[model samples]
Target: MSALPCPCGSGSPYRDCCGPLLRGESPAATAEALMRSRYTAYVRRDEAYLLRTWEASHRPAALEMDDDAWLGLEVLATEAGGADDREGIVVFVARYQDQAGVVAEVRERSRFARQAGEWLYVDGETHP
Candidate 1:
């Protein structure tokens, strides 16, 4: 069974939580910290971190998130995953601001994979 009343308010819980992600053990947390950190990377324009964490099969030729457009992040939910239940998904919403300071949003259901026990971001299904 999945954890409930997720601490991040994503409808998931602590044990089945983003726990691993928070511990830096799982690419996807067993909580929301991993997703939050990833969002921070976008705001900080940390392309290297992003690239290093992306799965090779899905790594982009030129990946970028508008620095000025990135605002903050919120992890909605996560699922148990993996070869040993190590794979997982993070449902989230990333908010940002344009150069004009206009607010924009990138709400997406992001997929994350654990390779060799390392959590590498795979991709996402973006929501408008």
Candidate 2:
């Protein structure tokens, strides 16, 4: 089956953008790519992919994602996370609609690391 548009707002279909990465068809080449794929994972409720992309040091033992309905993702900026870089940062805003039908958005600057030729999310500091 064909996938939908990537929730990461790449304007490309999920199959072409983050789908392959999420399905383990390929590894994210950059920090921003990892961040985008993670957001898409949240939308798809693929907790396994979420945990896999997370750094072990910060990865939680378990995740509970049954709450809010994720609406969309908007990547704000990036620094240093490239194919050759060992570390990188991505700034983004993710919008969600709660069960109450109230909409909210969260802004974060996330850090990532490249280990064993794979980029993984380390941590993030939310913006007010």
In terms of lDDT, which candidate is strongest? 2
- Best prediction by TM-score: 2
lDDT of 1 by residue, 1-128 (tens): 23543333344554455444433455543323455546645655666666767789999977756547564557677776444555677788877778887888888887776677666777889988
Which run of 10 residues does model 2 get worst, by summed lDDT? 1-10
Candidate 1: residue 38 Cα off by (Å): 1.6
For model 1, what is the alpha-carbon lDDT of residue 33? 48
Q: Over all chains combined, what TM-score does candidate 1 have?
A: 0.68
lDDT of each: 0.62, 0.92
lDDT tens digits, residue span 5-27, model 2: 78888888888999999999999
Off by over 4 Å in 2: 1-3
